[model samples]
Target: MLQDTFNLMPLWAFVAACGVTLVAGFVKGAIGFAMPLVMISGLSIFLDPLVAVAGIVLPIVMSNLLQVMRFSWAEARAALREFWRYIAVICVMILIAAQFVTMIPTQTFYLVLGVPVVILSLIQLVGVRFHISPAWRRPSEWIVGLISGTIGGLTGTWGPPTVLYLIALDTPKAKQMLVQGVVYGLGSVTLFLGHLQSGVLNGVTAPWSAALLIPAFLGMRLGFWMSDRMNPVLFRRATLVVLVVAGVNLVRRGLMG
Candidate 1:
């Protein structure tokens, strides 16, 4: 049983997992994405996939909740209204896709996730730019929400498409972060409910989830502290590079599996 296996995991493994969570958390705090992309991909190598996923879920949700709250309710409500259609599409797709998550072969799942992130990172790194105008809003948003939610449901990676869409929107930095936080927090709630229905949230995942919280919170705090000192451009570049590497590794794991 998963519980029996989890109980047998060594102390060092837990410690290492916590360390990784801290690093991933810091990156998440600094950049506002990549927490799951970095942590889950890395931790899965050492821990059970279920445990890894469970460990990161609450931290991601909590962090985003804090971020979303930073904006006034009026601002948040306005943002939600603007993106309501896309959010609705994403939520429905995520609920539908949740059922198939376990059926997906881990290798294939990783490949599907890794390839696009890597490509996107490379494009961004090269200064390739695409802008979304008012004319392109509807179709572009639908596409982004659909793809992002699908991937999020399957692999816990809903960041890339939404990030790309927001980038194209050319929003101000504060608003961009706020929107991303709100979307992620909302998506996390959907995922949590879906996992609960599927029995993915239970005793087996609970201990590790609790254990991971310390590192996750610490990492987030550290990242927040560093954010003011860090150059935005440098932080983005570093994040892109990390994403590219993690994406490649995921592809390799998928192919090997």
Candidate 2:
């Protein structure tokens, strides 16, 4: 049955993935987060994790590049300087973790991702309040960077930890979004190179990546349009719920596997 299902995947699967990409992109564009989470979770339902990751890489890179480009060079440079150590650690860890991708079992992947989603969701849902001390922010930045990079390399979903850490910093929304875009843009480039080195960038994944751009662009446009109208509190709450559900589903899938 599994083999039959795999063999039977048709154009509709691609279409569905594209649709999800649109939604994910819109969310990212509008709010500056959730694209990776939304896209990877949604896409993983229809395709293998590796294919989903590959499909997302180009669109995310493009989207983030456009976002970061909107910022002035001075601002971008300042932000990069502030976070350079963190970024450096993340890049190095991502490269190292990428080497071990082939060693991760599918079930293990699901569990590793699933457990975190649940915990993060519950924290948000319950309104857990914890702040990183100013004195510790520098070191914490490095820690978050390492975590994000490692997870990103392994699962192709790397935004949550960085997002959480940035949120803790109390940065203005615009700055937060810009910094995320720039950081992710850098990470995406590194990730793409890593995948290429691992030989995961093949014709099959390449076409899928191209096809995904349409929906991704659509989503980004929608998200941009909706950004101002949406309430931040509501959006965060909804995202947490989605995370919880996705986490549970992934855990279940892992257990079954």
Candidate 3:
């Protein structure tokens, strides 16, 4: 089945892709986000860019469902209600932007996805926190949602912008995790559908995506266990460092490609 799906890709490359998903899942479980970023950056090193995007779809959807289930259905519903505007904008923008995915140059897509991730991750690492006043929250949500959705549609990674918006809001840690799960859960569904329309998730790629769910699930489960035993502050910083390195690697690939 795997060979039929990724006939052009070597067995080693397929194994490596599974490893990437495992690590991505671990990071998401530990720090509450970044699975797509890690998967995109790592898989693109070995797979076609569109294939990398498609490969993440199933794992992301499944991981997010697990994350959301960690909390109650009531909490998920409440989050959806509170952030409906942002969510709605993101869904619409993802559908619109996804149509152009096939038109973007691979190098341009890499730079577009990598540059912001590197810049934003560095800013957070350097202790620069964004602040949004109560009056500006509405507008900020719309703006960020649009940006996040567009980037997400293009690259299959939208956690950074969403995380930034949540940080600026000064959301409590517990609430932040729940909100991330809720937002990303819905966004993942849209991503799947958008790419389906774009032909990124057709018969050939869908099997590869589905196969990756195994490692992603295992890694995330282990990560959840580890997270309970580790210090969150330290884990988050470590995750950010990994993001910086992965982002830098993507930029390098773009420049060198």
Clashes of each: 1, 4, 0
Candidate 1 residue lDDT tens string, 35-61: 878787778777766566666767777
State every prediction's TM-score relative to the real structure.
0.92, 0.91, 0.97
Candidate 2 local distance difference test against the native:
0.78
Alpha-carbon RMSD, each predicted model = 2.0, 3.4, 1.3
Q: What C-alpha lDDT values do all the predictions have?
A: 0.78, 0.78, 0.90
Query: lDDT per residue, candidate 2, 18-86, as tens digits?
Result: 788888898787778778778877887878777776778788877777678878989889889888888
Q: Which residue pairs of candidate 1 clash?
A: 107-254
Model 3 stretches with alpha carbons more than 4 Å out? 1-4
| Superposed Cα deviation of residue 249, candidate 2 (Å) | 0.5
Choose 2 or 3, whichever is better by TM-score. 3
Ranking by TM-score: 3, 1, 2
Q: After TM-score superposition, what is the CA distance of residue 244 in candidate 1 from its true location, in Å?
A: 1.1
Worst 10 residues of 2 by lDDT: 1-10
Over 1-257, each residue of candidate 3 has an lDDT whose tens digit, in order, gives 55669694788998999999999999889888999998998998888888898899999999999999999999999999999999988888888888798898999888988898898889878878889999998998899999999998888888989988999999998999999999999999999999999998888899989999999999899888888999988888888898899889889878998
Instruction: List candidate 1 stretches off by more than 4 Å.
Output: 1-8
Error of 1 at 223 (Å): 1.2
